[model samples]
Target chain A: MIIDVSDPADPRLADFVGLRDAQLRRSEDRFIAEGLKIIERAFAAGAPPRSLLLQPRWLDGVLPLLTRFPDVPVYVGTEAMIEEVSGFHVHRGALGSFDRPAEATWEALLGARRLLVCEEIVDHANIGAIMRVAAGLGWDGVLVSPGSADPLYRRAIKSSMGASLELPWRRMGGAADLARLREAGFTVVASTISPRAVDVDAFEAPEKVALLLGTEGAGLSREWLAAAGAHVRIPMTDRVDSLNVATAAAILAHSLRQRG
Target chain B: MIIDVSDPADPRLADFVGLRDAQLRRSEDRFIAEGLKIIERAFAAGAPPRSLLLQPRWLDGVLPLLTRFPDVPVYVGTEAMIEEVSGFHVHRGALGSFDRPAEATWEALLGARRLLVCEEIVDHANIGAIMRVAAGLGWDGVLVSPGSADPLYRRAIKSSMGASLELPWRRMGGAADLARLREAGFTVVASTISPRAVDVDAFEAPEKVALLLGTEGAGLSREWLAAAGAHVRIPMTDRVDSLNVATAAAILAHSLRQRG
Candidate 1:
């Protein structure tokens, strides 16, 4: 079903309310997928939709995808009412509430050859972009630090172009996870700007590698840098402080791609 | 000069008004640099300062740099007043107005071994991020299509972390510029996700190369693609449609970096 809706304050529209409030949405159990494309991506990734709030114009396009989920409510409304309920301009007049998938297990990641370990790379867009890069470059998985931004956040998922839904990723428990990964025969290489760091292009590719990346502020923690098998730096012209986290991640992901 | 201004609409503060109106600022002869760090970067880049609008807290920090341009106005006010003047929340209570520097000449870019030619990459942040990547990866210079976003836009400059000011970049007159670049002995490589494109890692890079990038919405125009010496693509898995334009640029720049 397509159920009609006019009242912005309708109790059924609670999930769509204040969609712009990142803080409010963060503590919720379900993640919101905005726009027709992302909503479709969520469905493709087997994310069960709790409900969908959209305008009548989008009903025909979305109906085919909802065939498997007959129980999920499809709340149709006027553009004005949808905006009123969302408390923000929803992109392309569609939003889907989906059950957040369970975190990917370390065992699943351990079976892979290449991975990205993010240390406090907490910007939502950056995290999302990294996931997109990882997925595109065919990195096996990603592990975000405890303090990193939620990859499931709406903007992050959107920024990742729905890769967050498909990529195998989870919150890394702590720095100790690094030790365990190393013990499992994965070489941990940190991406740093330290002058003594080996140039990534010049470094030898290992059989199994975990590329460690850090935030631009403090860089990889001194402790984490020391624990890594090697520190690799992308050579620069000394004009910029550092590349944006996501940009740097893409370069590293490309450099460390698992060649067939 | 420390000039206290409490009113946002004061005629003397005309250069700093409505900083959020990107179109209005773009038409003017100067560009706005938001945040104290960018303001410092602007000075360090040797961009002439027209004026400065900042809160009193930043006065001491800015005064040392303004000794050479003692005549440039320094307007100080409360944070609230500064926000009002900017028509947005000013970054760390500072914004600098600098004379837009002259564009880099084709001859200057022709001398470089590695360059980037952006085709309608209109997003300011993407433009800035690409500049930062180019600067970091040692790309000699950048040439943007006529419709591309201004690298000196406030957000672009901030996104670039001031690399927009330091990096050698200029806008090309039209598609004819590409033909001219080819005549200048630069291999024009188009970056596309087209299936027929050669993988960047597999494609042999030329000694003098100008990588062509397109907008994410549409790949490079047929004319540009046809003109390219080679069409190279970064290998991607099936998860994401394509990498973000900036992310893709970084990968390509790193892959085709000018090695010493």
Candidate 2:
């Protein structure tokens, strides 16, 4: 299972090609786990390894993770060759290909007391950071709008520090799912910058709450804001209009946590 | 002031040469404001305009800002030439060179009730985002360790939506300044991941606060933490060790805000 590869054109290394070329769709069956820590996280998440391309120095560190998958190919290459295969420099000289984890079900998300629903948040890093905050703060689940970025993309996973793999999340089939979540007895709160919105802290937290966020440049759309049962704004000075969506998410997640 | 420049090598245009080059120092007297919106923000800040390199298509929009500084040269170029000079694709065909605003004095920072103290948080984007959150949430001033990234760096300015130019900030001469801030009647609070730290919400918000942030990778050093009057942490599940430093700053800044 340990194969040495000097040729960058080896078909076995296809999983890493054009990773930084900006052409590959990130929603493929396999997702990349870059760097040493994430590779370990992938195995810990019970991800099925497709292959691992690394250098000789990294072989021992990866051996423990591969004990269960002795048949899985472990490709070794010089640092230069590995860089040539992957579009960018592989951090710590490791790249992992693992089958993407299955999305969590709607019924599963409904079990949590606190959840985050992203409305068209398209940046991979923001999506990943939101997941990191959601998971770290003990939020039960995350739901992404249909147009959201793939959380399994390598950069997103890296930004989340691998929390995207552990967090229970799913892409909503459509916007109507917002109403469906409300029908399930969850208070859907939309974050906005509108003047009439109540201060975030002044609004009381309910037993089951779903906090909604929006994209980077423009905030929650008119249609989405009107759909929510309540609108809350982070009180701020007039000098700056809004915080980064991810930063806003962290603030809201921390503010609205259920006290023990 | 409208000068036609076909040569990218023109000495008068040295302010913008290799703008995107990694090797260039960004702490110069003039900071770049890329994109039309930031360029307009720079003008709105009453920032002194050194020059503007923009395409002819953007001329009409920029004309209003240049009327007061008729002597400031306006270099006109094709989109291709602008990219060649700046070392990257110029976002929407505009880059402005504005004289850096002066840092705020110690007296000015102490005059405010709430302040942010950053210790070696050197990433340009994080510095910018911190400033944006600080400005948005009505925080008074910011103090950074001498090693922090220049908030006026082009990317930082752009990331802060030009709040870096508007926010009051300065670098501390030494870590002793923490004690100085405390002596000035500020409650210096250090953020950390240590489990023994008090939960952020449980801590009382003093009349005056100096929320201390740590470096990007490894957090606040031992010396700085010992100097802080209080230690607070955002309560979280044991999944991730810590949130991104900027995200942590936003949550703490929001959580510990004076309720007045």
Candidate 3:
């Protein structure tokens, strides 16, 4: 279904408004991915598009993508209309709306030996980086805490190089949800800078392990650390205190996977 | 000396132009640290300010800072002039220009058991984050390879929470520098994603160790790996290939420090 609309206020374009809001919600449910390269990667990775909105100039470039998702609707609008619809300047030439993938269950995500459980990491870019690392390093999946930023936010998707769409991940409401992992034989390792924390290297990878990280400012809440099977600290120089949460998570993920 | 310059074209303010350009350079001889709090922290850390440039409204707010650095020139400019001089609008109310600190020698930087050797990691934010982690975790210092971005770049410094100014660090010219480290009894561990690389946790941290990190996209170069005493990888799942370089570096630093 190819529909041509010249108006920016078209009701069909509601999915792409105020992307920053979606980031705060911890869900990409109402977000859209822009650009041909990103959309193609998502499609190649088996992500189905809900619809395609594009300018006439992009038709030639987008026709090839349309062939893949034959049933997906393609909406054509003027450049001026798209600018108004997106509520910002977007010169990406093409955009696509896709339904957020179903949330993965703890069992589904924990099937792999190495996992990351993000605690209150609210930055979209950091979430994206974590997903990229997770996908790049072959981590099974990421379990994002409730307060963490949405991985599907436009900036995050862009930062992840589309890996947020490809990586296996799920969101947990809070620390209580994490308890189930331990019952399922996953050793929860909380990464912190506390004095009593064990060296990250000291932990031998168990049959299954979950690396927990929090925001850089406050670090992991004491409750989360107390619940962990072990508190892990990355050693550092006396002058510096902590690594960014995403960076620390990646290192720990890599370490755990190596041990496994 | 207090110089009141009504004109924005004064040549004395040349160092503050195109602040963004500082990040592109191989080395920034000087950079601005904005915000009163960060400037205070830098001063407390013994980083001398080269000059204090401020708006009239902030004159009283910054008078105390000037007392500590009587030798440093203090420039008061009108709000319009300061904005024009900075090229971009800054709302921090004041800015301080600081000369880049003298580079530390490899021996001085490697005084501790653990050190960070960043090889060509160009992102300023990543460099800053690494510095912050290095400082927070009590690492000795950072050694930057020739191609790496300057740690003193404005954004880098800000992202580091001003720790970049306080951290003991040096810049090595090339592979020969690694050779020098080896001769100095520092074990060089290059981080890569190669299947054959030993797990990061398994790599022993010698009394003196330099963890080598490469640019984010390409893992450690072959020459670097060959030159390194050991090639280590953060274990990750099959889907995720790597972590952000800075994150990887921090994890490595923390791990080495913990073991030490």
Candidate 4:
């Protein structure tokens, strides 16, 4: 249903309020998809939209997608109203409130051949970029540690360019989960900068592999590093110590990806 | 020299005012380096420090580095005062104003073996990440198009982990510079998603290589692509359209980096 809303404080626009406030968004089960492209991606991924608030200009572009769910409300408002409600200039004046999908099951991830396991990666943008590269390179799924950033967060979704909507991922329980990956016939490899770590190029990809990435500053925790079956490091000049987590993810994902 | 300034508007603090204002900073012949780490990197790179504005709490940590530049003024102030002057919460209450070094001469870059050529990548953080990866992977230098973001910008330098301070880079006059690179015996390879582009893994690296990267939203411009001696692409599944420019740079830099 299409509903025209004039007041920024209208209770109908509650889903769109305080969009820029991360803490407020975190407590809710719903996630916001920004811009027309990501909204379309969310729709294509079969995410159910609770409501949409967009300018009249975008109505025609979004009409076709709304056909699937005739009951979901589409709140039409002015760009100024959206900025007022959301506390930020809504990108292209389009935003979709969607029920965050349930994360992939551990069984589903274990059955996959390639998986990126992130440990305490707290940056939303970094996690999003990791998901984008992981999906682009055809990795089967991803497992983020309990302390990692939410891939479904707006900034993360935007950074992933909507890959978070398509990629199969779940929040891992804890460090003990490394044993579960190994038990499922996957070689757990830690990406670290330790001097004794095997060079990425020199390290052979096992038939099934789970690449472990760590937090931005500290890298993988010592407990997580010790649990891995193998440790791999990207060779680099001593001039710099490490690559950004996402940048390292791309290079490692490309180099160690399962080949036909 | 130590100066304790109470007022944010002190003329002596002019070099540090409006540090968050990019436009104001762009027109000057100097750049701000944030945090003690980046400030140290700037010092290690031998960039002359014009002045230092930092909290008194960090005085002991910065004292050792100042011994070398005894003539440089070190202004001690409260974090609130530094924040008031810089227009942002200065990271760790440490900031340095340094003379932006001169661009590396064309002669210096032309002699390098492995070079990353950026084409209008206007995001400061993206350019910074590109520089960080290029430096980490041992690329000899970088060549940015006339329209690319300033690699010396504070955000760029911080995103690069100070690689922008150490990596030798220069802006090209225009597309005609590609010919100069070719003349220097470097293969001008464009990183494109064009269907006909050779898979990066399959393409053999030339003796000397200059890999071209494009802007964020759009890929490489046609004129630049047409002028390239070769086109290469990282093979990826069709799920995502392309990798982030910085992510692409890291993979390409690693795969095609000059090796013994």
- B-chain TM-score for every candidate: 0.97, 0.95, 0.88, 0.96
iRMS for model 1?
A: 0.8
Pairs with backbone N, CA or C atoms under 3 Å apart (clashes), candidate 1: none
Query: Candidate 3 residues B61-179, lDDT tens each?
Result: 77787786788877888777777887767777678887666887755764566678888878888888888877876677888878787888777887898888887888888878888
lDDT of each: 0.89, 0.88, 0.76, 0.91
Residue-level lDDT tens digits of model 4 in B111-199: 99999999999889998999999999999889999888888988999999999999999989999999999999999999988779999
Error of 2 at B5 (Å): 3.0
| DockQ preference between candidates 3 and 4, better one | 4
Q: Write the per-residue lDDT of candidate 2 for residues B28-98, one digit (tens) a residue.
A: 77888988889988998999999999999888989898889999999999998988888888878988998
> In each prediction, how many residue pairs overlap at the backbone (N, C-alpha, C within less than 3 A)?
0, 0, 37, 0
Any runs in candidate 1 off by more than 4 Å, and if so which? A18-27, A77-88
RMSD of 4: 2.2
Listed in order, each prediction's TM-score against the native is 0.95, 0.94, 0.81, 0.94
Q: Which sequence of candidate numbers ranks them by TM-score, best first?
A: 1, 2, 4, 3
- DockQ per candidate, 2 decimals: 0.87, 0.79, 0.50, 0.83
Write model 4 residue lDDT over A91-167, tens digit each, in one string. 68899999988899999999999999999888999999999999999899999998888899898999999999999
Which digits, one per residue and each the tens of the lDDT, describe model 1 over residues A1-260? 78998999899999888877876676788999988999999999999899999988899889999999899999999889988998877758998999888989988988789999999987888989999999999998999988888898888999999999999998888998998889889999999988898988889879899999999878999878988998898887788888888888888888877776
Candidate 1 lDDT for residue A63: 94
lDDT of 2 at B172: 92
